[model samples]
Every structure is written in C-alpha cells, then in structure tokens.
Target: MSAPKPSKRPIRSYVIRSGRLTDSQRRALDEHWQDYVIDYEPSALDWNALYPQQQPLTVEIGFGMGDSLLAMASAQSDCNFLGIEVHRPGVGKLMHGAHQAELTNLKLMCHDAVEVLEHCFEKESIDRVLVFFPDPWHKKRHHKRRIIQPAFVSLISSKLKTGACLHLATDWQPYAEHMLEVLEQEPTLINHCGPGKFWDEPERPATKFEQRGKRLGHGVWDLLFRKE
Candidate 1:
C-alpha cells in the first residue's frame, strides 16, 4: 500500500475587500514602486544587503493604509523596517508616504505575509515582527482563516532570533483571546506580558482602521511575545 500524503495547509489569511484606489495611490504604484518596493521571490532575503547598515530588522504584516507604519519608521531611523501587505492601494500609499518623508529605513512587499515568512525570510533572520489589527474573520466557520494559528505562530517563531519579539494587536476580544491561546501554546515563545495577559498600547501611532475601531467603543488588546 502507498503511504498517505500530507494534508495541504490553507493559503489564505484574509479576504481582500473591494475599495477603489485614488489616482495618487495608483500613480505611486507606477512611479515610485521601484524605490520602496521589494519584489517577492521564493528565496531568502539578505537583510544586510537590503539596507545600508546591519541594524535590527522589523517587519509589520498587514499594515492597513500604513499610517502607523509610516509614523513608526519615520521615528525610528536606526532600525530597518519592512512591511508586507496584500492590498495594492495600501502598498502604494505607504510607498508614497515613505518617499515623502524621505525615509531610508523602510521597504515593502505586496504579497501574502505567510508565504513571505516561509520562503523569503531565512530562519532566525528577523529581529522583530508585528501584526497589528489583522482581520478578525468573525464568523465561526471562517475562524479557521484567522492568521494566529499554532502553525503560523510556529513559522514566525522560527524566523525570529532568540529574545526577539512578536507583537500583535486586535480590537476584537475573541480574536485577541484566540491569539493569546495560540501564542502561549507555542513553546518557542514566551509572553512578555506574562502568561494569559495583554500588553498596554504600544508606542506606535494608530492606523486609520484602529482609530475608527476605537471611536466605535471597541477595546484594543496588544500581545508581545519573545522568542525563548
């Protein structure tokens, strides 16, 4: 008898919403993309080659409209920042913002973050990773599509250096709890906020999405875990 094959992992963590792009955003894609964008390939990226100096590398996943990411990168000149987002408009907007700010410490990838972690980032190459306000996928059946699963956390843990951090934020209570459960179960990660606790709001500026969520009375939760 033939051996059983391994089951294929799910490829999607988010569903792209249909939001029309402004002309400026589209124009940025054409004119400024080469300056700020990193083309995704199925090969490991060299962090030292990508930036001028060998400083700490931080990557933010799903940076919606990139307001907070732009602010953080602008404030932190010594550390290099890379962002991965599936939305073309967000990528273009961030590119434009980074260019306008004259920021040299930032780069971007327009692709699924999971694939990027699996292929483009070598093991223990990342110093810090951020996942802020990811889609909650609120429906019970769609919960499987949420990104904070054991396998996903494990993959992130593999890419983080020892003592490096993984920071996650969510406005949805259930998803935040789920994230806590998932991260705690990963033996390679230790909670910086203590076991089963959430962190205070991070120093980064708030994205438009987060601001809107806050205006509606939704509470936000942040989780910071270090690689053990």
Candidate 2:
C-alpha cells in the first residue's frame, strides 16, 4: 500500500464574525448589490471586459467598511478598484457608499480573497494590490493563519504585473515584521524600501479604524514591494 496521503489544510485567512447589519446596509445589499458585487467563481476573470475602459486596476483585500477604498476610488477615476472582504456588512456598506458617491470605477467581492486571487485572477493581470490592516492572528499558535506567508505572497506575486506594487500596512508590530520578512524573501519581488526597511506612510486617505488606532498610540508599519 502507498504511504498515507497528507490531509489538505484549509486556507483560512479570516474568521467570519457575524455583525448585525443596519437597515441602510440591508437596503444597499438589496438595491445596489447587482451594481457592484461579484459572486465568487472558480474561473478566471476578464477584467478588461468588466470595466468600461481598460485601465490600471487595484484590488484591496479585507477592506473594513470601505471608507478608505471609497476615498481612493473617488480620487482616482483613472483606475478601477476591486475590494474583497468576507464580511457581508462591510460589502453592503461599501455598496451604499459607492452608490451614494455615484462611483463607476468600483466593484466588490464578498468571498475569500485568497480564493479570488487563485481562481478568478489571471497571472500578471493586476496593476496594484493593497492589503491594509489584515487580521494579525497575533497568537503564536495562530500565526500560521496570518495571510502574509511565503506561499500566499508567491500567489500574490503571480497576480501582479511587472513593476506593479504590493502595498501592505499593519498596526501589529510582530505581524508587520513577519510581512516584511516574507515579502523580502519573494524572489519575484523587489522591496520599494531597502531590505529590512519599512515604507513611509503612504498618501492614501486614512480609514477610521486607523485613526482610532493612531489616537491610541498604536504604530503603523507599511511595506511596499514591486513585482520584478
């Protein structure tokens, strides 16, 4: 008999925490979902056909409630934006904001971002990827569940075009260090800052959560790596 096959580990970058939805959020999901939300699919996506014009694309993973994403989309009409989050309330909130802003360049997916990148995105198809304030999974035993491991970075690398940037920010110091280490080891990526260094605070609008953390004296670390 052959040696026992290894069991496949689940890819769990997030724990789905159910939050009660506001009436406005429910209204947004009911009314505006078709305009912005993309259901999860296993097939590759044709991004050019999705938007009105082929332009630089940015995908933000785990955008909490989407205040910053809305800001970016509003400020950058030349780029199309996609936001992936497992939280239904966040998705609905983003949709409401997008509709209120009359944004034509934003889309959303309520699913596992890792799965979306693996199955829906073609290699070298994305212009920029943003992962801001991902769950730190701070416990030693839970570190494996953090999203910035080598394999995940490799998969992210495959989805980015040459010279495209992967920007990550975290409020947790150890997790930031881990992100830096993993991103530095990716052969296909070149650090925007030199090895072992962190990037300066970027110009993107600050999210409410980030502002709250800042008020509490929490430090933020940013990492920018380019596909090379």
Candidate 3:
C-alpha cells in the first residue's frame, strides 16, 4: 500500500497571538459583544440594515488595539466604519469605546479579514479600504504570509467602487516596496500619488504603531490607489 500523503496547510496572513485581555476588555467582550460586534456569515451584508442611515462605508482590516479605528469613527461621524480584527481583545476594547461614546456608525468583526472581504462584502460596494501597519512577516521565507500580495490587492480593487480609494500604510521600507510593487501591478487601481511615488501628505490620523515606529526613526510609506 502507498504511504499516506501529508496534508498541506494553508498559508495565512496572520497568526493569532496569545495576548492576555484586560478586565475591561474581557467584560466588554462578554457583555457588549452583541451591541457592537457582527457575527461573520458567508452572505453579503446589507449596509442599509446595518447602519442607522445611508452613508459611505469604510472597511478597516487588522485594527490593532482599536485605537486608530476608534479615533477615525469618532472623528468621521458622516462615514460608517466596519473594522475586521481577529484578536478578541482588540474587538472588545473597540466595543467598549464605541459603547461609551454612543457611536452609531461603528461595527466590528473578529474574523479573518480576507475571508470577510471575499464573502461578506459585495463587489463594487465599498467606498474605501484601509490596511494600516499590517504585519510585515519580515523573514524572507515567510514573505508568502504577507497580506499585501498581488491576489489580495486585486481582491480589494474588485470590491472598491469606481473612484473609491484603497489606502495602505507600512513602516517597514522593504514591505512598503513590496506593497507598491503588488499594488502597481493591479490593473483596476490607479496610484493617487502617481507612479512609483509614495503619498507625502497623509490625511489619516496617526496610529499607535505609526507613532512607535516614528520614535524609533523608521520611515513610513503611504500608498493611495483609486479604483477605475
């Protein structure tokens, strides 16, 4: 008899870290989950029913600790924000903040962002997609685990509405170059800063990761691409 074949493990962009949750984060997760969190489903979400009123929708992938996302939601009351994060603590913190602020335009999902984007969101339905400070997966052999690849960029581009923007930011210079190369190859997107140039004047609020990187003297790169 032939030997049993080894099963292939799928490559994922993120690895869940065993970060301990604070008391408030735990409490929020247990009590306020239904108020601010959405259960992931394979079907496309109905935005009309999700938000209180019709507004431009922005989806943020991997909102670490929810600081930047919370700030954005609070600042941009006119836009609806949907944040996808796999970490439970981050979701809980964001929920706590949103509940405290009585925010009506913010929702969250604790799931794989790639699956969420591919299954829950309809093509040409999103106004903007933000991926800020994603894990670089720095090792050469682990480059396949990076999220900013050609296929993922194409997927993002397909989901964006015409004239909508896809904004990506990274502190790692090598990862930024990788992102630029992948994004430029996507036919559906046009770089807002012109070819092979990074966005010099970023209007988005600074993230906690960005601040930390800046203090360490790391250069940051922002790439803004618009869907055609």
Candidate 4:
C-alpha cells in the first residue's frame, strides 16, 4: 500500500539567498513550484506509478547538501529530478536554495535510498540515477552501510531503462575504486569511463562541501555505467 501524504506545510521551509545558488537557478525553482511543492515522506511515494506524463525523470539518492541537484534542475529544464536525502540540514539548504533560486524541475524527499528503491519504484521506470559523494562509511565494520555494493548495483540496474545511466562521483579514491570495481563486475552495466565524464558531469553550481574537499587535496572521480 502507498503511504499517506503528510501535512501541507512542510515542517521546515528554508529560503536560500546570496549563497551557492545562482540567480538563474533561483528563478527556475520559483517558476516551477506548485502546491505540494515538496514532499518529505518517501515511504508513501509510488515512483513506478507517479511519473508525470509529459516528461521522464531522473533520481539522485543521498544528495549531500544539494548543490548539484539545484544546478542540474536549472541546467536541464526538460527532465525532472527527484532528490532523496536523509539529512535535515541538507534538505533545508536545498529547498531554501531552490526557493531562493526559484528551481522548478526538482522535488524533495527524506528517506533511505535503499528502501525507497526496493519498495517505491516500479521496475524499469527510472531514466537515470545520480549519486555523488555519498558517505563512504570507511570503517571496516561500517562498510555494510555503504550504498554502492553489488546488491544495490543489481537493484539499480533493474530499475533503470535499458540505456539509463548510473552516475556516481567521489573524492575518495578508495570509494571510487570500489565503486568502479563493483559496477564493472556487474553484468547489467557497462562503463562509460571516457574523459568527458568529468567535462560533462551535468553542469552544476559549485557547493561549499566541494570547495572544502578540493582545498583538502581530494580529487574527484566520476564513474558512469549504462544499464544493459
């Protein structure tokens, strides 16, 4: 059964201004917002059933602090993006930024990406999936918490259309390598590891987290895999 919808007014409404969001981004969010502008509950979502008839959708799991999400919404007006994040501060920041920048091609939800994927989305519905800089959970014991394991790759592959892409970026070489290994080994996906992966990583506005990661000498690597 689908989960019931939450209250009309969001528990927290943030308005981002003079920060990472560009004027154009803010404007896009504003132009596209509507009643039920954002949804925080992921349990009730019926991803397989709720797609807008007019356009295909892309999803981003664990959209850390949401800079890339808003930027992508502005950069690509044709496709809608569903952003799933468990972090309240990040949600507030993204929504605030979206509200401030007037981003319309995006929606919000807070939940576990795994549960949502397994329960909510119907088979072969997603056009693309983006996971950028997810928490590495680097500890040996906590590695189970990492989201890029084989099972996830299998599930993600099942959900994506034949040619849909799964894109992930990480500054941690270890995580990047692990992800590359897993994605490469998966029979359902093929690597798109060309130089353009960096040059064409969906044009996004810069974020503070990225800036900090850069200053710390962390190099970012993007891995693209297409569902077979």
CA RMSD per model (angstroms): 3.0, 2.4, 1.2, 9.0
Q: For candidate 3, what is the lDDT?
A: 0.93
Instruction: Estimate the TM-score for candidate 4.
Output: 0.74
Across 37-132, the per-residue lDDT of candidate 2 in tens digits comes to 888889998988888768899999999899999999999999999999999999889899999999989999999998999999989999999999
- Model 2 alpha-carbon miss at residue 137, Å: 1.0
lDDT-superior candidate, 1 or 3: 3
Query: In lDDT terms, which candidate is top?
Result: 3
Using all chains and alpha carbons, the TM-scores for the candidates as numbered come to: 0.94, 0.95, 0.97, 0.74
Q: What is the C-alpha local distance difference test score of each model?
A: 0.91, 0.92, 0.93, 0.72
Q: Which stretches of candidate 1 lie over 4 Å from their true place?
A: 1-9
Question: Candidate 3 regions off by >4 Å?
Answer: 1-6
Clash pairs for candidate 3: none
The residue-level lDDT of candidate 4 at 135 comes to 74
Judging by TM-score, tell me the better candidate of 2 and 3: 3
Off by over 4 Å in 2: 1-9
Task: Show how many residue pairs clash in every candidate, following the order shown.
Answer: 0, 0, 0, 13
lDDT of 2: 0.92
